[model samples]
Target: MIVSDLWRYPVKSLRGEPLREAEVRPWGISGDRRWMVVDPSGEKLWAGEHHDMVTVSAARTGQGLRLRAGGRPDLHVDEPVDGPPVEVRLRGVGHAVSAGDPADAWLSEALGRRVRLVWLADPARRPMSEAHGGRPGDVLSFADAAPLLLATLPSLRQLDDWIAQNGGGAPLEMSRFRPNLVIDGDLPPFAEDTWNEVQAGEVRFRFAEHCDRCAVTTLDPATGRSGKEPIRTLARHRRWDGQVWFGIRVVPLNEGTITVGDPVRAEGTRSSR
Candidate 1:
């Protein structure tokens, strides 16, 4: 198998950016989910609950952070905010960081509510889950299950065909799922189900679980518009293990930069044990 695509979300619970190459870190890709939006009470916000204008895309510019929406001009933050420290959680992991007032103001105006932007640099941080056996260097993420998600081209095509038969307009692009790595092999749907270890370049990842479908998939990553086709199509044909499975979650066993076209080798199968 070969890698066909890669992505990163600079801010948790927002639109993601496609990357040609990226530096891998213990928690995840550098800058991936390093920032997040939260309420005045330090509660983190997510696309799944609040489908407001706050689902804007963000990126790191030479100066600082830049944000843009469908019709809004880009907002930039060159200086960090000064505020009382607060703890934010990704899944269940907690991180103590400061929130910038400018970010809060921008987000408040965009969503027509009060909110703030928090960074993940405080040493008091802890990952959200203990089930995966959080490692010393591992960073817990807001991802549905694992720190990384992997999908195969053939499986996506199969879903597209199935959607077409169900009268869904077109096959959605892989971006809708926001996977960190998109592999090019012809694997069956849920094929990662049997994989325990996979190697891409020098990075090693352990397949953990299947990512279940969520309402966030209904939102159009392009325009931030919500629809019913993708979720509806998935519900009818993708349900497995009592849940609608869509992607495979993975945790990096070893860290290294994985680029597009990198060869992928599965080390062991579930049945091998």
Candidate 2:
């Protein structure tokens, strides 16, 4: 198999930037999900709760990050250099520094709510849940659990076929899943389901868990509209443990670069378990 695409969501819940190559660190592709939008209470706002969160796109610049939304002026924000810290509410105890007023105002207006922008300059502040296969020193950015999620084109093709068979409308866009890496080539559908570890290019990864499908995947990325989809169809075939699953979450094992077209090798192709 080979890596077909790579992505990094600089800001959680927003549109991501595609990369031809990425610096892979333990925390994931450098700069991914290091920033996020929060409520006035400092709680991270999610696309599931606020669909508009995905409508506002963010990109990185030399200075910091940039935000753009339809009918709104672009907002350029600089990294918070020792800025006032905020108690970012998370599933676990976590902390982040505020991105200041301009970002807060821009996001608030765009998402139709009062929210603030915060950056996790140091990802080590939030530990991945031990229940999610996190080991000692395992850290995450604003990512829900693991550092990266991987999907395969073969699996997607199978899913689209299932969706059609089940009368679930057109083939879904891969963007809906927001996977960090997309692998393509000769492989059985859902081959990743058995991967305990994989080496893509120079970077190695440890499997964390199967990523459960969520309402976020049901949102139409381009239109900012919500619908029943891949999730609904996933339930018909991939459901287990009371959840529909799709991609697999992975944590990087070593620091290196992962690029598009890099050959991928799954350690022991099938799980020894």
Candidate 3:
């Protein structure tokens, strides 16, 4: 198998940036999920709940962060190095630094609500939740679960075939799942369910858990339009344990650069490492 695509989400919920290569670290890709949106009350906002968030695209420019949305002028935000600290509720009590009022105002104006941009300056400050299969020393970014999510083209093809046989609709896009790494190879669909470790390029990662699909997957990342194809289709065939599964979450065991076209191999059994 080989890596087909790589992506990083510098800000949670906002659209992600596709890359040809990236530095894989313990927390994930180097710039992934370093920032997130929160309300004045300190509750983290999610695109799954506030669909408008997906409309705003965020990218890391050579200088700083750039945000763009339909009809709105593009805005550039500098990283707040000495910015004021703020307490944000992200699954657990977490700490972050405010991105200041200008960035906050721009984001709020775009999302059409009162919101603030908070950067998780130190991802290690928050412990990974044990309930989500976190192990010791497992640092987490603003990513929903583990550090990375992997999806295979073969598996998506299988799901697409199933959807076609069911009702003959359009094929679902892989963007629906927002996978960090997309792999393609001569393997059976759902073969990753048996993997405990994977080696991609020079990096090695241990499996964390199967990623569950939610309403967020029903929304198109480009237009923020919600649909019922993938989610509805996943429920029919991939449903189990009260959740519909798609990708697999993993945490890096070693840091290294991973690039598109790099070879990928499943290295361990489900019980190993």
lDDT (CA) for every model shown?
0.71, 0.89, 0.87
Q: Which residue pairs in model 2 clash with each other?
A: none
Decreasing TM-score order of the candidates = 2, 3, 1
For residues 1-273, could you state the per-residue lDDT of candidate 3 as single tens digits? 999999888899888889999999788998899899999988989888998788788999864699998998998988888999998888644678999999999998999999999987777766677777799898888888888899999999999998898885787778778889999999989888778889999999888898888888889777888888787878888898898999899889999999999999996576411
TM for every model, in the order presented, reads 0.87, 0.96, 0.96
Q: Model 1 has how many clashing residue pairs?
A: 4
Error of 1 at 123 (Å): 8.0
Per-residue lDDT over 10-73 for candidate 1, one digit per residue giving the tens place of the 0 to 100 score: 7777777888887776666666776788887778787878776325888867536787766666
The prediction achieving the highest lDDT against the true structure is: 2
Candidate 2 TM-score to native: 0.96
> How many backbone collisions does model 2 have?
0
Ten contiguous residues minimizing lDDT sum, candidate 2: 264-273
Q: Which stretches of candidate 1 lie over 4 Å from their true place?
A: 53-55, 78-83, 89-95, 122-124, 132-137, 142-144, 271-273
